[model samples]
Target chain A: MIYRIRTIAALTIREAARRRLLAALVGITVAMVGLSAWGFDRLAHGGALTSGESTLALPQSLILFMFMFSFVVALSASAIASPSVASEIESGVLMTVVTRPIRRGEVIIGKWLGLAALLAGYAAAVSVLEMGVVDWVSGYLPPNPVLTTVYLFAEGLLLLTLALLLSTRMSTLAAGVVGIALFGAAWLAGVVGFLGTTFGIGALRTIGRISRVVLPTDGLWHGAIYYLEPPSLLRAHSLGQNENPFFTRSPPSWVYLAWVGVWFVAVLGAAILSFDRREI
Target chain B: MWQASSAESDGLVAAGGVPQATAPGEGAATTGSPRPSVSPAIHTLGLHKRYRRTVAVKSLSVSVGRGEIFGFLGPNGAGKTTVIKMLLGLVKPTAGEAMVLGAPVGDRRTRRRIGYLPEMFRFQPWLTAAEVLRLHCRLLELPRPSWEQSISESLETVGLAERAGDRVAGFSKGMQQRLGLGVALLGGPALVFLDEPTSALDPVGRHHVRQITRDLRERGVTVFLNTHLLAEAEQLCDRVAVLDKGAVVASGSLSELLGRHSRVRLKLSAAPAGWTTGLSAFGAWRTEGEWTTVEGVDPDAIADLVNLIVAGGGRVEAVIPEHQNLEERFLELLQEK
Candidate 1:
């Protein structure tokens, strides 16, 4: 059983590699990392700022960069996974595969594992490389880098699961559009909730909370943003208010994390069930 | 060895008028007793499918014995593909039951022993031919030690041994079809379902598929073939079922279906003007000039026909016997339906 799944995952990875999509993703991500590193170096050495000021502000800048990285990861997950099954089925590629001794659920889980592994690995490596660059250039490193990467990876997995679920029932383009649109809506709601908390508006706060509960991408992004804040900003943000979208005041509650876990399983299960019932 | 018809194979065959094929060594053991396994390779009773109000298939019943080449014939909307899908468990049957390889269709163990080449014959374009074979080997749960040999043998069988390292994107439609056939033949499946197995092939490729199918039958493997090429079916099938409009319009061993209506064309001189009148007992006869044509003459009674004409005060000039080929019978059946 494990052999079949491992072989399928390996095949998926090989397909991605041979198609050069992996290469394109790597190239674009590397260029982004290089440009960000240069910008950080300019902030430290070429900008009008004292050493202490640059040090204090650089982690906030890194948080902003990390936010961009998180978006990139979410988008990648949607693009890579949304069409994975739907297109194969549409083209009759899965005809021979499903008729084999393997079950439909195995195919879905194996593909999910392949994409999750690729996306999570990409998220972790990019986060570490960007943090190291920030620390080297401006001498400012965020606390809990490992925890921050975990959140980003989980966020990618979450989006990937949604994309996969949609792939079972929709076309590649439709699934990707819906997946990414939901992610954007959740993030916008999170920002609105932050503003609502600052202005004492209850309705916007409820919308944000409900969106996070429904999708969890924004909630996971908040956890990642919280871990990227420097201690100084955390103090100031707490004193003033949670007015910024790039930095957060506290980590997500364990209950919310637990709910995210449940949500992950429910969506993955639905994907399997939907694919199982679908006439291929 | 080609009988031009399979009707005689029915007496020995125990399922749906298709004779059972003993395995390589089972013939020796069969002299003293019945074959150990009596289950037909495929057995279906009242199978059906529906998409909303549209009925894709209905009241489909068929039986195929082990080691026989069963041809499934049909028109464009005849539900042939749907039947194959239901038998392979790719589509859910709305009603009735079908058993394949001694178990229910879509059963895991049964599927493991089955191979399928779908009509489209597509694969991931990025993978090489050899990689595709290897992927199937793993999917088939073959041992690690056997994977290399199995992949090599399959590639060799499909004549893709030289192109095994090439990506599928570089393959032509014919090559992709050969590759699909090679994949279906892998793991030595006991039953293989081939849908339009030669639709994209050239003469050489079609010949290769025919040879491979014959080889599969010799190994006591049951093959269920679906093709629009009636000539190919005439040359390959032991028994055939003609489907039209989601139902089996005609079915039996080829000889049983085709042999019942064979034709005989005759040329005679010095025959009486009414000599052909009593020929109705022989068959449906038509006379034009010196020629008299008869249809539906049984192969066994053709000699009686010539004797009757000779006794009717005619000097027989020439007697030409023409058996109704599958294409003719297929068209006739469709037109009648």
Candidate 2:
């Protein structure tokens, strides 16, 4: 089983590497890195009088930019994970491999590992480049940088797992589209939940909680925001008083993080089960 | 239920030796041998599959002997592929059981020793032929040391060695088909399921495939071949099953199926008026000019014809026994339904 999983993982990575989409994703990452570098350098050295207010706003601004990159990670994971399984099922390419000695669970896990590695590398590389640029120009860094980077990857992983579950039951296009739509809807619900909390509306607050439970991408991103925001910025604009979608008032609790892990395992288990029972 | 019918009808097996069960290993047991009998390579007992309202395979039971090339013949929608899938563990049977290589169907360990080339298979286009073999080797968990030599030999077997470095995306349909064959032959599996293995090949390639199949059998491998081409089956198969409407309509040795309906053509001179009446013992006879034909003449009836022709003062110019090819036998069987 171990050998089969490893073989599948290695082949999956090789397959992804040979695709044009990987090249496109790499190019997009490079352009985003370059753009962030130039933008930060201009902000730092423009001599528009380096004021205390701008320095104070640095963490908030950086979180906003990283949030954009997190969206890229989520989109990339959704794009790759769905088609990885669904297209093979549709095209009959998986018939030879699945009929071998390996268990269906091994195939699913191997694929998950491959996609996880790819998404993790992308998240780490982009986060490091963006953080390095912010530090080089403004000499400001977010608190708990490592934790922030992990949270961002967790967001991508959540989407990846969700997309895989969808692929077991639907077409590639339907899985991809539904995955991204859910991600977007969850983020909007999270924002609305913040508004409800501020305005004392119970129904709206419950909507956000339910959406997070259904799809944890937004919840994971909020955890990332909470980790990436500066201490002063977080203290000044307590989440309820702030309108910024990129900031979190408090770090997600230990229980929530545990649920994220549980959510991942449950969904991944469901995917393996569905795929095993599927006709092809 | 079906095995009982086969046992009763198989007078030759019972009369020639012992009463034999079609089930594998039973023949050896009835002969009082406990020396670890080699079971038939494939054995199915009333195997069946259904997709919602439609029954894909219904009560299929056949045993293929080891080292024999077993052909599965069926028309469109006759469930040949479904039966293959069930035996290979690619699909689950709705009822009954199948055993391949003495293990239950869908047994993962047994699958390790079996190779398959599905109809209309397409390898990953990005991988070169060598890389594809490597991937399959790894997937099959064949030891690392054996893969390099195996890949080379397999590619050479399918005549794809020169194109090993070329990506499958650039391959023609025939080349891809050859590569698929190479994949199936890799790791020296004990049994190979080849579905329409020659569907896309030219005549030469088809000949190469047939030769490879024969070579595999020579090396003690069992091949369960599913094909629409009866000539291929007739040339290679030791036994065959014809499936229609998801049921086994007919199955036996090629000669057994075709010989039951044999026809003999006779050209005679020196007329005897009552010769035609004597030939009635050989089933139905038709005469035109000096040529006479007898349809459905069994082996016993042929002797009567020769004796009557010689004793009646008729000159037997020539007697030709006509054998029906597989295509004709297949069509005749289908029409019988």
Candidate 3:
């Protein structure tokens, strides 16, 4: 079983590469990173500001860039992993593979591992490159770059798990659409919660808490935001910057992180079970 | 209940039209010595499946002995694929028991000895032919050292050895089919289920598939084949079962079915009055001048028929066996259902 799962994982990764999904994601990321580096150079040396002034501006702007990358990661993860299981079942590939000695759970786990690795690798590489360029241009790096990237990778895998679960019982397009929509909804609720915290409203705060518990993308995304805080943002928040949507107040608690882990395992288990019971 | 009908099918396989299979391992059991009995490669008792109001398979009880080419014939929407899926553990049967390779269906260990080629015959298009085979080698858990050799031999057997390096995206329909066969042939499984293995192939490809199937049988591998091409089944199958409305309508050895439905034509030179009435004991008879055509008797009974005529003071000029076409026989059986 171990050998079978490893083989399946390797084959899936090879499939993603062969289909050029990995290449496309990498290409778009490189273009984005290059553009960001050029923008940072202009801000620092193109008469817009001094290096010190630009470094001061880097925190919020860097958060914005990371936010964009998060969206890219989420979308890519949804599109790629959503179709992995559903399309194979649709095209009759599952019919052939499952007849072997391998179990259905192995296919699900293998696909999950393969896709998780791809999305995580993409998320980490792009985060590191973007942060590196910002650091090179202005000597300003996020205080917790590694944790931020890890959170970002976790966010992508979270969406991937949900999308893969939906794929077990739905069409590829349906699963992707539903996954992206939920991500949007969760993030919106998180913003609402942030507003509630700013205005001392308990109902909206509870809504955010419930939404995050329901689906942890926004919760994890907020943690990524918290970790991506540059020293300038930290000083500003220390002097009171709680009203900013980009300014997360603190890292996710152990309870929320535990919930995310539980949610991931549960959804993945459901996907495997659904696939095992499916007639195809 | 499972092995009752499978290990011994004397009750399920009554005389006449209902299919009767050879006892499992009867072929290898040399006469005068106790037979080394091996479980049938596939056994199902009252296997049934239903989806809401749709009944896919109903009471599909059949047994396939080892090393035999058993053809599963059915029309579209007759649940042929469903039965195959159930037997392969891809889909669970609603009710009944199925054993493959001496264990219940869906046994992962037992699956190591079984191979299946689905009707769709799809493989990962991104993988090369050799990569596809190697992936299955890993899935089947074949020895790591034998992976390359197995891929080479399987590709050569399926006539895709030269294209082993090409990705499936570039393969033609015929090439894909041969590659599918190559994938199925990996690991040297004890039993293989081939669903329309030749559906996408041309004449030469079909012939090649036939030869490969025969060779597998020669190697003591049981092949459960599902095909719409009756002509192909006629040429390849050792025994067959025809399914209609998700039930076994007719099944038996190819020769038994063809012979049982054959028309025995006899030309008489002498005479006994009302000899045509005696034909009723055999089957319906039609007389044309001195020639009489008899239908629906075992072909082996033709000799007894000749003796009857000779004892009745009638001289027999000729006895010719005109076996019915399997295609026609299947059509008649389905229409009867």
Candidate 4:
């Protein structure tokens, strides 16, 4: 089983490394980080917010930048993962491996581990780079960098797993589109739930909760970002005040975190089972 | 329920003991033996497969002995691939049973003893030829010490050792096919299924592959070869099965199949124009200029024809025994249904 996993992982890494998508991902991530630094530098000069005020506001900007970086990383990771298995099957490369002594489930798991390793590496590098820039400009950094990085890596891993599962039944293009759409919808739903809870809208809050439970990408990201920022950022604003949701106090609860782990295992298990039964 | 029968069959010590027998019109004796049995390298009974509405394989049954080179021949889309896939457990049969190495098809244990080279093989373009072989070795759990040596030797066997470090992306179609075969032979599998193993090769490349296949056979490896290239099958196969439409049309040793549909062509010189009148007793006779052809030649007819031609003042040039080629037999079987 371990050998099968290693083989699949090696194959996946080789394939993913060859795609033009990885280069595009690196370019976009580096550009985003550079752009964020430039924007912060400009905001630093404006007297509208003092150095101390901007320093405090650094967490919000860092969280927002991380969110954007996550989007880029998730999109690229999912796009590559979506085709990694399906295209191999279509082109007959999978036949070379699957017909060997290895089990089908082992192939799927190995691929998952390989893609996860890649996404984890990307998530860690981008998060640390962006956090470093935020610290340099505003002298502010997250108290729990390790926890925040783990959460980010977990979010990417979850998205990759979902993309792999979808790829088993759908084409690569369709899987990528659906995976990204679900990621956006999950985040949107979580926001709606957050607003409903704060404004006493019970039904809307229930919808948000259900959406996050259904697809935990957004829920996990929100929790990770919230954990990285200061508690003061989440203080409720007045009716006329305009504030980003990054300033909301009600981050994902412990129950939602537990459910996210459960969701991860469930989706990954389903992906392996579906791949096992698939004809290749 | 299906699982129980497979387990029972696996426990049976008799070699090739499935109750289903080959169709009986050919008069070929069933070769059954009893000593501990190499355990039915491949077995299928009533194996039916369909794509939507068209049945690709219907009630196909065959059992291959261990360490035997079994040839599977058929026309295009004649269920040869369908049968091979069923044995590999790649495609599940709609109805029927397929067993490999005494285990259910697709079972990991059975697969460990089997290797496969699919027809129209395509490898991961990004992987080097050596990486591809090593990857397969890793999956097959061969020891690390043997992995590199086996990879090199397998490539050398396929004549791709020089291109071992090169990515498959730049490989020609024939080169890719060779590398695919190299991967299949990496771990020294006891049973190997090769579908058109030499389909896209130059004559020299084909020769090399045939030699490798022969070498495998000599090493006591059972080979189940599916090919439309009749000449290659004739050269290497010990026993063959011909499939038409979705069923086995005819099967047996080359000599046995030839015996059932024998033909003799006689080349005569200075034969009279009215030779056709005297040759009607033979099964089927045609005269193209000086070459008179007679098919399904019986010994009595040959003697009579020689006597008539000699008595009629025509000298007998040469009597040639024209055996039925696989292509002719294949067509005959197709027309039979």
TM-score of each: 0.90, 0.90, 0.89, 0.87
Summarize candidate 2's per-residue lDDT along A1-280 as a digit string, tens digits: 7888888888888888887667888898889878877777777777664566666567777888999999999999999999988998887778888888889989999999999998998889888988988898878788878888998999999999999999988999999999999899999998888788768899988988888888878888888888787767766776446433676667777888888889989999999999998876
Candidate 1: where are CA atoms >4 Å away? A50-56, B1-36, B270-287, B297-316
> Best DockQ goes to which candidate?
3
Docking class of 4: medium
Q: What tens digits encode model 3's per-residue C-alpha lDDT throughout B85-182?
A: 99988888989776676666787877878888888757888889998898888888898999999999999899888889998989997888888888
Candidate 4's error at B85, in angstroms?
Answer: 1.3
The C-alpha stretches of model 4 lying farther than 4 A from their native spots are A18-24, A46-48, A51-57, A191-203, A236-245, B1-37, B266-282, B288-291, B298-318
Candidate 2 Cα outliers beyond 4 Å, as residue runs: A47-50, A239-244, B1-37, B268-290, B305-317
lDDT (10s digit) by residue, model 2, range B1-337:
1243343234112111233334444433322432212556766767889999999988776777777898989898899998898887778899866667766667686677888998867888989999999998988888899999999999999999999999998998889888888988888888999999999999999999999999999998889999989999999998888888898778778888898778898889877777676677776888899998988789557877877888988888898989878898899889988
C-alpha lDDT (0 to 100) for residue A177 of candidate 3: 97
Interface RMSD of 1: 0.9
The 10-residue segment of model 3 chain B with minimum total lDDT is B27-36
Sliding window of 10 residues with minimal summed lDDT for model 1 chain A: A236-245
Q: What is the DockQ of each candidate?
A: 0.72, 0.70, 0.79, 0.67
lDDT of every model, 2 decimals:
0.84, 0.82, 0.83, 0.76
Each model's chain A TM-score: 0.96, 0.95, 0.95, 0.90
